[model samples]
Target: MTASSEARETALLAAQAAADKLATDVAIVDVSERLAITDAFVLASAPNERQVQAIVDEVEERLRQHGVKPVRREGVAESRWVLLDFVDVVVHVQHAEERAYYALERLWKDCPTIPFVDRAAPQGDAAAPGTATLSADDIDPASADPTPLAPAPGDGATAGGGPLQDEDPSAPEAAGR
Candidate 1:
């Protein structure tokens, strides 16, 4: 049994909203087969407490725009992990530390992941083919924001937004530019 259409839509919307706030590793898990309370879960990670709060706020705002509101919320005070339960769907915005420690993906490994399309990334452009796309792990927490997180690594695109040339001189984009 998979998530219903309505549940999937809500989950995807929350996932996109989290991504809009620069949340990382956005994933949607179909928990309908396991849980009766909710149909799906949207999991995302933030670099810190403030970012966690930001992601949560954005997720809530975006969902509300869709005429949906969280039926329950948890872990907002510390901002380490915030769970927004919309009944049909649940959004978990966790700080990097909490995400690593909890590893929600591992726990839900048995369940199939629902496809998530990040509206932030252009359509048909999952990423530049052949270019190593950056992930949250590649980001330098202090140097990622504001700076465009694109192009080859070491090309001043730090996760936290810092200017540092890639050490590799062999890579065509960074080394030649």
Candidate 2:
């Protein structure tokens, strides 16, 4: 059998969210013929632990819009690799090193790949070719002890990255000025 339309839709949305958050090599693998559980798996790679968390958060939020929730999540603490089990679609967002080491793609290489399209970015121009436009959600604002956000290496941005996440977007804060 093949992945149902619902499963495919979820996988695609997950992939798009991952891409929006600067995840790399995002792809969907249909594992229905080999697995009895999920219909497809969405795989993505982040350069660092922070980006890993960011991608995961985006995936969860975007999927939630469709009224879907992950049944289970693992490896969130380490942030080297994270898994989101959304029943029909399982998403794997991994760090660069972990992605190369685990190589889940090789295991499911036989499965046909489902195309991923990021609606927010046309022509695959989500960010500059080599730069990532970090978002406020990149850092966990709800952490027990929140840490400052540092721009990822090679992003060509300062430590502040973009607009202050805490600042109100509607009106510019003139306190510093």
TM-score of 1: 0.71
Per-residue lDDT tens digits for candidate 1, residues 68-173, read: 9988999999999999999989899999888899999999999999988676575556674222368899897657665555557434564434334444556666
Error of 1 at 174 (Å): 36
Candidate 2, residue 102: how far the Cα is off, in Å? 1.2
lDDT of 2: 0.86
Residue ranges of candidate 1 with Cα displaced over 4 Å = 122-177
Q: Which predicted model would earn the best TM-score?
A: 1
lDDT of 2 by residue, 60-148 (tens): 99999989999999999999999999999999999999999999999899999887755555346566433446577675664634575
Residue 100 C-alpha lDDT in model 2? 96
For every model in order, what is the number of clashing pairs? 8, 0
lDDT of 2 at 37: 92
C-alpha RMSD values across all candidates: 11.2, 13.6
